[model samples]
Target: MLTFYSEGSRLRQARTELHDGALVTPFECPERLDLVLKQLRQSGLGEIRTPNAYGLAPVQAVHDKDYVTFLANCWTEWVSAGHKGEAIPNIWPARTLRGDRIPRAISGQLGYYALAAETSISEGTFEAAMASKDVALGAVEHTLKTGEPSFGLCRPPGHHAAYDQFGGYCFFNNAAIAAQRALDSGMGRVAILDVDFHHGNGTQQIFYQRDDVLFISLHGDPEVTFPYYSGYADEHGQGQGEGFNVNYPMPPGTSVATWMAALDQALARIHAAKCECLIVSLGVDIFVDDPISEFTFSSEDFTLLGKRLAHAGLPSVFLMEGGYAVEAIGVNVVNVLQGFKQSME
Candidate 1:
């Protein structure tokens, strides 16, 4: 598999994350990518290359234009407001609140566009987020050009972002953007299989009403997980996209067999859809040791997971989402890629 990455991705480091009603150092930090790169080199899979510049057009395909503008300017606006220390949203438009109205204050805008308070916008957030989008787009291009699977090692993971809202350390929905790019590039249909530990609320919402892309996610049950508002099986899509959205929500401490069972079902759905392209929202946070995620998947299980995905035989693009087990993250991620490579033979 080819790997796409960028050093600029390290710039979106947030100084603080609002967790459990308190500020703490973020779990999604720059070092996560370092270990992934180290393991990629050690595995001898492929060289990590800088991504191609796809620009804002591809990114805007999946994200809201005004929201994209907000992301690009929020950091600067925050700085100009004379308030320091990474911009974290303190307020949100809850039920009964007016969401249609855009706030003029930078502080209010931060809250308005943010899905949650945990994702803080640091100085270089917009730049790093754009670089991450490039990584995803470049990986898609690699898959298209080489006729082989490609991996986008995206940072500040993007599963919890929505069309206009950003959260869960994600400023832009990289996986959704990649899927859209596939469709825009003339692919008949695209299927996104998100195996991230947390539900890809953002990706699901991006295509919930569109039939061109099918979004399936296997993640921790939203009933007791982070971003606890979405991810139920009932959110099967709306309008022309009905039945295109699939969600497999498992309880915490879910066993590997159970997880794989869900994977098989998701794969079957992808096969049934007859998707022309595949995008895996690859996240290793389901590992037993992941700090913020729960699931009993051992490192070796990732290999099997990858092998099964490879069995599908679709041209695939893997986009990194969330995996905070910093020490073992590299080995786990490489295991999946290596497994897929071996399976392709």
Candidate 2:
């Protein structure tokens, strides 16, 4: 497995995250990538390559132009507006409120583009986001060209970002962008299997209305999870995308056996869809000791998950998503990659 990464990912050093009505240090910090890189090297998984610059075109392919513009200039605007602390949305266009208008004030604009208030924008956030998408794109290119598996160690993970909103510590939808790039590169059909602890709401929304890309996610039940709005079983794709989107929302403390069963179902659906490429929104937060998520997956289970995906026998790209257990993150992620490598042999 070839892994794509960027030192620019360390630029996003936001210090604030809203949790339980109080501001605390963010769980999605730069060290998450550091630890993962360390483990990848120590485990001798494969070559670690720095990603090439793909610029905003790939990002604009999956995200709205205005949203991309907002993310690029948000930090400068917030600072010029003289607001104190990192930029976090204090208000949002809730139910019955006008969401059509883009606000002029930085604060109002933050609310306009934000899906949740947990993520704060700091200096270099835009740069880091750009690099993160580049990493994903690089991995996609590698997989498509070589017909092999690759990993994108994306930081400030992106599954939670929607078409025009940034939240859940994600500024840009990296996995969605990678999938779009794969499609643009002439693949007939692509499937995204999100095994993250949280549902890939942004990736779902990006491809929800298209049949060319099948989106499937297994996550905590939205009723009790962080992103409480989406991720239900019934929120299937709309229009031409009907029957292409699948969600398996399990309860808290879901056993590894049950989770593997869900993976089997998702793999079966992908095989039926005849997808030419596979993208895994790899998140190890399902680990038993993760603080934010509730699941009971052991480190060894990740190896089995990787083996199962390898058996699918499609060109694969694994994009890093949510995982807070900093110490074990590397082990779990590398376990998956190593398992896939061993299985392929």
Candidate 3:
């Protein structure tokens, strides 16, 4: 499998994050990607390459135009306003805050467009995120054009970001942008299977009202996971998308067995959806020792995940999302890819 990456992605690293009531080094650090790449090399499945820039046009296809502008200028605006620390949101448009108008101030706009506090930006965040989106879109283009699989190694993972709202270590939803680009480029029925540890609330929000795209996710149950809301079993799609959305919210400490069972069921649903292409929001944080996730999957179990997805028999693209098991992330991710490659043969 070809791995899509960009060096520019490292420009936006946040120096610290508020973790456990104290400021600690960010778990979503640049070293995490480095460790993952090292593991991929050690595993003998290392195939990596950078992508040609796809520019802002592909991004605008799935993101709100004004929201796109906000992300591009957010860091500069924050710095221009004299705040120098990491750009974390201090407020959000909760149940009471007016949602109709976009705010003029950087903080108000940050709160207006964000859903949670997990995502923080530094001076160079927007460039890195846009480059990351390009990485994912480049992979999608390769898969769509050649009917072969490619992996997008994006940082500041982007499943929690919606069309307009950006948070959860995401500025723009890369996988959603790629999936939407696939749809626009003529894939009639696309299936997005988010196998990340956290629910892809942002991806779901974008496709929940559309019948052409099917969204399925397996994540920690919202009852006990981070972000604290959404990801419920009852969040079925609305209107034309009613039967197309699927969510498997497993309990904490879920093992490989239970997780695979959920994945099997998701595969059945994807098959029923008659999906012509598949996009996997692959996050290795489900590994047993991952700090931020609850599922207790081993590194080797990722192979089974890849094999199972290959059985679905569709053109596929894999987008990197969350995973804080920096040490083991590469192996876990490659195990799945090698497993799928074997199954494909």
TM-score for each candidate, following the candidate numbering: 0.98, 0.99, 0.97
Identify the runs in model 2 with alpha carbons over 4 angstroms from their true place.
none
* Tens digit of per-residue lDDT, candidate 2, span 1-345: 899999999999999999989999999998898899999999988899999998888888888999989888999999898988999999989888998899999899999999999999999999999999999999999999999899999987999999999999998999999999999999988999999999999999999999999999999999999799899999889999999999999999999999999999999999999999999999999999999999999999999988988988899999999999999999999999988888998
Per-residue error at 246 for model 3, in Å? 0.6
Per-residue lDDT, model 2, residue 237, is 99
Cα RMSDs, all models:
0.9, 0.7, 1.3
Tens digit of lDDT per residue, candidate 3, span 182-262? 988988889999988889999999889999999999999989897668889998999999988889998889988988988
- The whole-model lDDT of each prediction reads 0.89, 0.93, 0.86
Considering lDDT, which of the candidate structures 1 and 3 is the better prediction for this target? 1
Task: Please identify model 3 stretches exceeding 4 Å from their true place.
Answer: none
Candidates by TM-score, descending order: 2, 1, 3
Candidate 2 residue-wise lDDT at 340 = 88
Q: Candidate 2 vs candidate 3: which has greater TM-score?
A: 2
lDDT for predicted candidate 1 compared with the true structure: 0.89
Q: Which candidate gets the maximum lDDT versus the true structure?
A: 2
Candidate with best TM-score: 2
